[model samples]
Target chain A: MSVAIVFDREVAERWHLREVGVWMFLGTVVMLFAAFTSAYVVRKSGADWVPVHLPPLLWLNSVVLLASSLTLELGRRPGATARAASTAIAATCGLALLFFAGQVQAWSTLARTGVYLPTNPASSFFYILTGVHGAHLIVAFGFLAYLFVRTVRRTDVAGWPYLAGLVSTVWHFLTAVWIYLLLMLRLA
Target chain B: MSHSDSFIRKYIFSTDHKIIGIQYILTGLAMALVGGTLAGLIRLQLGWPGLQWPLLGKLMPVGMPSGVMTPEFYMALVTMHGTIMVFFFMSFVLVSGFGNYVVPLQIGARDMAFPLLNMLSYWIGLLGAIVILLSFFVQGGAAAAGWTAYPPLSAVASAMPGSALGQTLWLLAMALFIASFTMSGLNIVATVLSLRAPGMSMMRMPLTVWSYFISAIMGLLAFPPLTAAAIMLLFDRHFDTSFFLPSGLIVAGKLLPNHGGSPLLWQHLFWFLGHPEVYVLILPALGIALDMLPVFSRKPVFGYRLSVYCLMIVAVLSMIVWGHHMFVSGMSPFSGEYFSISTMLITVPMTIIGVNMLGSLWGARITLATPMLFALGIIALFGVGGFGGLFLGNATADMQLHDTYFVVGHFHLMIGGVTLLGTFAGIYYWFPKMFGRQMSEALGKAHFWLTFLPFFTVFFMQHFVGLQGAPRRYYAFTTYEYLNRTHGQNVVISLVAFLLMAGQLVFALNFIWSLVAGRASERNPWHATTLEWETSSPPPHGNFVEIPTVHRWAYEYSVAGEALDYTPQTVPARQVAVTA
Candidate 1:
């Protein structure tokens, strides 16, 4: 008697399901920040509003985030070898940590300059928008760390690509959101 | 494999979608009891103003002082009642519970796409409910600034007694609830998009699954703004930030230190989510009615494609029409007009949906089963409620009806009536499949009539009472000379409301009795053409022993030359050829 065998489904096909879930989550995050920014704009137009200069470290933090996005893109490339992918992931995690440090420095700078949370409308928006974004990045970092550890151990390489793809998408979207927030704060 | 699992794994912490759905339903039922009790208290206060509740005063001494219901407590009852009913009972029970349990089965899938996430969503939702319930025991009492919790009242602690710790806990609870809902919404969308069984294409899927899918998408898009608003309000309450607090606000003879905030900002953010949230509550009910209508009428759903298109249109229109809620709240006239136009536009698709439902029943061999009667009941109730909505939707009329009993009447009829009837219909239709036992039809019909009459009697008259200029949210009518005439009507409404509550006892009795002692259900008791019927009664954990392949649409009823009136989606073409 002859028997037929079927191989397991590919990672991309399965990842499509996970990808849909992740994108929907990102969509909500975008709306959340949009709501915050719009409220900030409305409040700024009112009386008793005091505008404050944001700390310079925010620009450096933006650079770190952009760099993290680039490294994740490099890791997700199709032809990248295992060692190359691990190196890219390590770089991504390092840049993400650096971005968090920069954000903390910016907050400290604002605090030192007497721009406290309740001092003015501008400062409140500053703390709130960055704090909310930082919270989201904390979750992203946890996912990235998982991806990094998995890549280093070479565990389930077939599934690893899909996880990498999801992490990359989230990182890039957050990077774009940060850039948007920065410009909005600067110009609006 | 399911049978061998430990008891705890099978019942308590199981990742089975069906068990989690049951958990959602049971939790929602428990919350409904609490919510319903709150409503009873509210009606009691309204019916006999200044009358003391002898027993309740001792039990809730903090809220009811000296046997009389205090104004603050009455407000808390209103707030908690709306919050629990909308979030815990209506949305959680009808939308999430049914969507989780029935969507996967009806669409021929074993389970949700992310089963673990589905499990987590239920637990988080339960945690949120527990937190909200706990808020009532706090020092300041439960949240009292209305369910909307508009912030000037909610922001300052001195504004209301319940604004202190209770509002904070309320916000925290809502945040957790939003998280749970967001996760489940993602699960539903992903599952429907990616996990359909073979040959069950988008068009072939049941209307129930489609409505769940569309509502999930709406939830995903709508809930985040509410979360954002909650966080901003939390900051306003505690961190001395001024998100919703305006300048020079005086509460209890003290000027609030907050500045540079717009109260309208909260209104905008809230209604943005609020309008779509109503659709989120009703679409599942509409879906239930649409699905049941076809099965009972023994006909293909009238304008199947049109119904789908209409749902999408309603969803899109629901988003833009939220501004209608703010027309009399001091929003710009132009913007209010825009909202009024958009709000009226929704009736076009709504009318189409109504026509299609009525058309399906024309000249059809109807089965007046328990589920069908409830479905017909929904049509009548929803028709009345939808027309009441038109009166409130018009900006000109809304100016007069804004804060009156008319608004309350319109809202309760539209949301409360439709969801209640639709939920009963679903419970009846799915009872056999859910428990492997049939509910008694006689008790079901009695429950429906009793509930239907009292619900309409209580709410429909409120419109006329409101036109008399009786304001809502008032603790007593004796204070205002003009409102004193409304007392008699209020007495009648309250009496009818109590009767409605009593009628639900029949449903409880019938459900409990049928679950244990009713007749055993066959595999397909309703002669339905859906995949869920192809599975065993109270389907196994995997849902199907062998996955069935679909050959036709879900509503294949009364086909010519067939042995039976219905042809299930799972039937193969070869069987029909041999029969012919």
Candidate 2:
């Protein structure tokens, strides 16, 4: 009798799980940063705050992240060719790598200037904000790379557009979070 | 997985929601044993301070040297017990266990929206459980900073023996738990949105699904701040960042190297998650009771819409009232008043829920089933717990009661007793669908009476002693003159707590014995209305021959002029009319 049950996979196809999941994930990530931002505000109000200087390279990295978002979103627009999408996806991944490189340069510059994680509360917040943001972006990058491979190889493109759409959603969110962290760290 | 799949594929790696659900329930029960033992140790120290226990001495020579439990070891037991019971058992079983098992089948969906994520959530949660368990044998013993793990004591390794590696392991386990919840919570929310069967509107969905969905979102949004705080705490401990440690602190007659940290910041972040976390632990259980009550009473649930609204209202209000937990801290008076008012406001929705439960059971053909008894226990106990909470939620009353046994009693009655009873009801009500067998009614009723009486007695005595200003987390109750007066009460509570623990064995035995030999349950054994009972007992993979089109609301029982006492949500209205 159990064998009589026949599940239709078609009904499940309409399930926009990827989109729903990404949105929920974005909510969690936002809360994490919100906590960090609140912590920064409270800590900055304390004595011995000793504000750290913003890295010059961080400005360039911010542009790189913003540009990557534009490229990914443009590639995922309503009517892009598969080849164009593949190229855009790979380019976005490359640009993300460049952003990471710039962040590393910023960190090294801070280290050269005799500032470490424990140097001052300001420096500690600076490193934590950037480091945690970078950690999240790295996961986004891996997924983007997977999409890039799929688009390039044409191996599994059944739901390429939907997959690309989810990728872009997360990509843009991280970019926005990066901006929020930058502003919070600078303003506070 | 196919029927012919390998054993590992069928059981271990199976993405089947039912199997995953059973896995979570069993794992939670296993962790409960560990937690219950920890509770036993705590009671032993409280009841018979300096009492010799050579058996425990052999197990932990450092903690129980010469058969006498130290202040530090007693603390570790307290920390792990709270940690295990709250996170591993209640949260695990209610949210993940029943969420996975019941949501899909009841909603008429085949499985979770993201089955792989659901699987990962369970395995990751298990890894977290194992990590916390391993913390016990760590160099300095298990974490002793209480389950909350407030800082300075938690930040400085030299502060205490348990603060060293055990605290780090505790942080790691907590981080893993957050990640797992993020994964599972996301899956539950997405599944509810993306996978509900046709005709099952939001209002048509079972109360259990709504409560689970609301609770999952609460966990998802609330847990991250705690994650953020854990990261900062880790930095303070190892990297000398001093995120939560104050600058002028002196530990063990030594000036600490840390400077410029606010321990209050940790409390804000912790309770941000911690407060909503209370709702996350109980809402699903509450939903379970509300959903099953109608089936046993043979009456449509009273004010179904109001019940759902109360669930959401309670959830949203729970998020904002977190500041009440901080009233005893150095918070401003204005903020204290605000939190106090917000916390008390929650009682309105909760009162409405209690009223609805009683209203649903009013003048009904109340069956004396095991699950029904547990559901009744939820209403009665949760009602008392809710009223008990008013004192703690108010700033004027809570300031004095803070950290007292009153606080302990309040939570035990609510999160501890009510949630556990609710979870047991879920297990008993759904046992037929889960395992194709009916648990023994005799044993179940016995378990309920034994557990309910002792559980009520123990916590009630705690409240009495607590009102006498007996502080909690104290090593020796006999040390204080005021507390010494409550010595008799402490012994009674301790012995009753042991009885509560022993009663759980009946449930365990009933569960195992039923799995092997209980009578097979037929489809819709209770003549229920929910979609889950419409499927085969021990539902097959994908749950349905074809996903059912839900035709009506979940609670349809004993309609006037109806031939059958209940009409399942799947039955068309025209068919019901013809039958009538």
Candidate 3:
């Protein structure tokens, strides 16, 4: 007796389920940062806190991050021509690299000012926030690089749009996270 | 695709979920032995202070020199014991092991959503366990700052003997464990949500799947805070960042350089994950009992929708009730009252679950299967444990019983006894499907009675000891005049604990013997009405050769005018009507 099992793959609803998994993961990442930020705020209110000056280069890094997010979202448009999408994807990866380099510069500037991690709680939070955000950005960069390679080589192009869409969503989310972290550091 | 394939592909590097599940089960059982031995050492020092352990003293001259355990050594054992039991034994064996083996089959899916990711999860969890086990032989013993590892003590290396490298290893091990859990939890959630059979709606799924799904969601959301906390703790220990270390702290009469950190930050982060984790442990156990009770009693489960809603209610309430753990930690009176109310409110839904199980069993032909006995045991024991929580949940009462043996008894009855019994039931219920062999029912029943008797004897005696104000985590209570009067109870509890350890061997023997030489089993050995029993015993690589189309709810037992007493979820309406 043969029984036909109608899996969700045919229902065109499988992609939505995968997207739910990805968003659930991103939700966890949000909580991790939420915990860190809450701790940062509480620790800052302590009597011995010494606030550090914000890095001048951090503002430039934010612009780079925001621009990359825009380019990635444009690349995700279903109606975009292949050449247009490729260019946008390439530019997004480049801007992400520049943003990473800008963060390194900010760290060096802080070290030069003698505001190292042990200087005070403020400097500690600055390094920790930027370092963790940079780490996630690197993972996003690697993902975008994979999409970049696939688009350029035209290998496995059938899966290109979906893969690019996932990378774009993550890249955009990280961009927002960076802005939030920068604003938090400045306001505090 | 025969059994004679290469060993690596068949067993080691295979992406088969069944093999991965068995791998988790065996590894967890082995770690339980290690965790159990650590408990033995802890009980030894607690019962007979400074008594020389004749065999162990010669083996480890430092920890138990001349057979007499030191205070620090006793502490180290205590820390590792809790860590191993909670993370390795319970997390791996009870949740991941059984969940991996059962979820896909019960959902009528061919395999996990991501088979390779499922394989990686187990290996990573095993690596985390090994890293923690290695901490035992490290220079400072094994993280004696307690399993919670709170700071200023945990922040400074010189604060304790095992605070240096041992605590660092503990943090790393825990970080890896969180990673593994997050990955596995995602897969379970994804599989359950998307991979149900053709007609299996969310409500149509078995209570086991719902429990596993809810528990997985809890793990996915809760583990990240602990990961973040572990990273911060690592920073405080090594980089002198002082995330958990406050200003003007002095350890060992030396003024510390660290400043501007709040220790309460660690507690908030820890308990956020820790309390939800209690639900993560118990929900699966509750799921197992709820799933098994109807089958044994030959009746439809009472108030199925109510049972599911109660689980959802408990899950949400458990997240907010974490502050109850901090009632005596100088928290505000208002916050304490809030937490107290939330904690007490949880018992309402918990009571509903217990009543539903009893209601289903009422006026029914109850079978005395070994798994049924364990399922019923969980309800009785967990009910008592739930009542005990009210005392601790009350802010006023908790002030006196904060770190007493009463709190210890409460958790052991709930997380310790109930969860372990639930796992035993799952093992017995699924052993046939897992290995195509039947466990000795006589041996299984005997194992339950032996384990049940000794378990209560050890943990129940702890409540009276706590009433006498014998505080927890102290290696020797000789310093307190009131505690000396409780020494006789301590001896009895410890002796009974050893008997509990011995009782586990009956289970071990049955489990091992069944795998090798026991009688073979057939499909639906228990005449159950679930998707898992619809397939052949020890389901093949793709689960079902022709995937079933589930037509009704999981428990459709004793439908009027039917030929059989039970109707499987896969049976179509036409067939069932014709039979009726």
Candidate 4:
């Protein structure tokens, strides 16, 4: 089942179709979240839906997420040394940690407000949507942490940047989703 | 593209498309066994309404009381069987299996666009299949709200009997399945677009790749809606959200404490994904038939562009006509008319495809090989099935035939007929390329005709019975007087079903036997112009020794002054003139 064939590096380099493929894949994910958010708006406008109050901790979490996105963007700068990249990566990691902690605090705030998951549909959606989005962000953070370790160990920056860029895109997406969730809560 | 492979790298967890295709085929075969066994039990229960079957009674105690099938259990079987056959068997085997194996080889690429992602996609789909099967073991049995999993029934645990842990697992499995499809669709689209050999333009690529590429696009666009629907359903079930559950939804005299959700919204979302899904299930088969017809007929495809455009037209039209499924669900009469017109208009593309196929076969040296037999059978069955669409596509006719065995017959003829027959055509046509051995033509033809005749008998009779007022999804017909008139017809249909089931055994036997004892195939058995046949049979890990530089179209059979009717794609232009 083996063949002796050689690929021309020049030919392979001429068409970086993998980049286009990755973009398409990422675009699909964006559209999925977009559809979900649209449904959120339509469903929220209906009567008999009791809109729960937003947890104050979510505001802090949103700021933390925004800061994490900034740190990730800075880490990708051209002249950043290994140490400088790691420093920015560490900031992203720290902010992500704070964001997770803030999410937990927000859940507790809802609990203290007598808005348990099973108590009402509104609380349930609040927990489920945010919880799912947070879980995805956690996975993104794990990828970033891996990149941070590799960068600190002086791995080639070229190889790591694409992965870092993907993680940053997902992180930015999550930050936007959180803002949308907050708006939905406030309007409700 | 070239690689020296160790045994482990070549076979086990191999990145090779051929190996991956075999893995998918074997997995699909296993799932088909499970799905077919379930169908057998369902048919048995239907045939004998209350007869006690020993193992079945033990396995499905709630659904089968001393072998008597309950409605909930019937629904569960229907749902699981449809889910397994469609997603696990048909789509998996046709698109993932054949598409993975052939698309790159046919277009002279070394491998898929992203090999690692392709591997992950298959494993994720395998995991999803496992999760779906696991739902059966859970308490309250598998989801019984139909494969459509329409909400209110699917959303409320108290509404349907199987809406407990089983429903939860069903949603989880579906979400995972959508993720798997998304990954696979990305790979297919990327591979076809970026990996074609030099001189192989988009139009020059084989129709099989085109069909797969279009199907992947449709899946990418459509599956996310279903994923959203699944997530929303999950929230409704576990999180007590009213996404698909409306207020004042009373069940068992208790009003569900939910509000502001429209179940119709779920239907719209589900069918937006669902209708294109039918094409996703069938397009590969259509592509297979198109590829096979020219080879077996010793002619180029007639109106190749027209055929490709027909597939695109069908793909686009399939997205809009899903509302026809909701005609009887209390949609506005005007909406029904709109859906009906769009649905009927799809026939134009289908008719164009049929005419192109016939034109390809016109005045050509036809080889009635087993593969050609199956391809011809598809053309005939697709015609029969397409005509039946006219009955259901008319709003007034659909009003009379909706939810009846007529709809069942129509789909079985369309989906099952095209998918199964077309897939077999692909398997038989490509067997030599995939396995390096020719299948027994006698056994293959036997399998084809036997399967084909019984399929028509069973489904064709169903249309008549449906027109006589027999509804679908019923476990028993012993009591309904109108249905009682059709008992004899049911018996005959059951016999045909039994024969159809048995015919598959011949195919399995032929397929298995060929791998071990059949005649070894030539390097280019069919003298096909496709780049796939340029390589050795059972194509190497990297697919080709030297990636083929395509100089002509795929269908250059019987060109003027050619000594042979066909020429292999790898034949150099200089050699061809000398040989001729």
TM of each candidate vs. truth: 0.97, 0.97, 0.97, 0.91
Model 3: residues >4 Å from true position, as ranges?
A1-17, B1-5, B577-580
DockQ per candidate, 2 decimals: 0.74, 0.75, 0.63, 0.41
- Candidate 1: list runs displaced more than 4 Å: A1-10, B1-3, B573-580
Off by more than 4 A, model 4: A1-18, A55-63, A116-124, A173-188, B1-12, B52-63, B158-161, B249-255, B570-580
Query: Model 2: share of native contacts present?
Result: 0.82
Tens digit of lDDT per residue, candidate 4, span B355-466? 9989999999999999899999999889999899898988889899998999999998988889989888988988999989999999999999898999988888899999
Top lDDT model: 2
Error of 3 at B483 (Å): 1.1
- Name the TM-score of candidate 4: 0.91
Q: Between the candidate structures 3 and 4, which one is better when assessed by DockQ?
A: 3
**Interface RMSD for candidates 1 onward, in order:** 1.0, 0.6, 1.2, 2.2
Candidate 3 displacement at residue B488 in angstroms: 0.8
lDDT of 3 by residue, B1-580 (tens): 2345588987898777788888888888999999999998888888899776778899878899899998888888988899899999999988999889899999999888878888889889999999999998888878888888888767788888888788888888888888888878888898998888898889888999999999999998788888778878877887888789888898889988888788999999899999999999999999989999989987888888999999999999988898998987899999999999999999999999999989989998999899999999998889888888989999999999999999899889999989989989999999999999999999999999988889977888887788889888988888988778999888989999999998899999999999999899989999999999998888887889877898888888888888888999988988784221
Q: Tell me the spans in candidate 2 whose CA falls farther than 4 Å from its real position.
A: A1-15, B577-580
- Which of the numbered candidates is closest to the native, going by highest DockQ? 2
Put the candidates in DockQ order, highest first. 2, 1, 3, 4
Chain A TM-score for each of the predictions: 0.92, 0.90, 0.90, 0.82
Report the CA-based lDDT of candidate 1 relative to the real structure.
Answer: 0.87
C-alpha-based local distance difference test score of model 2: 0.89
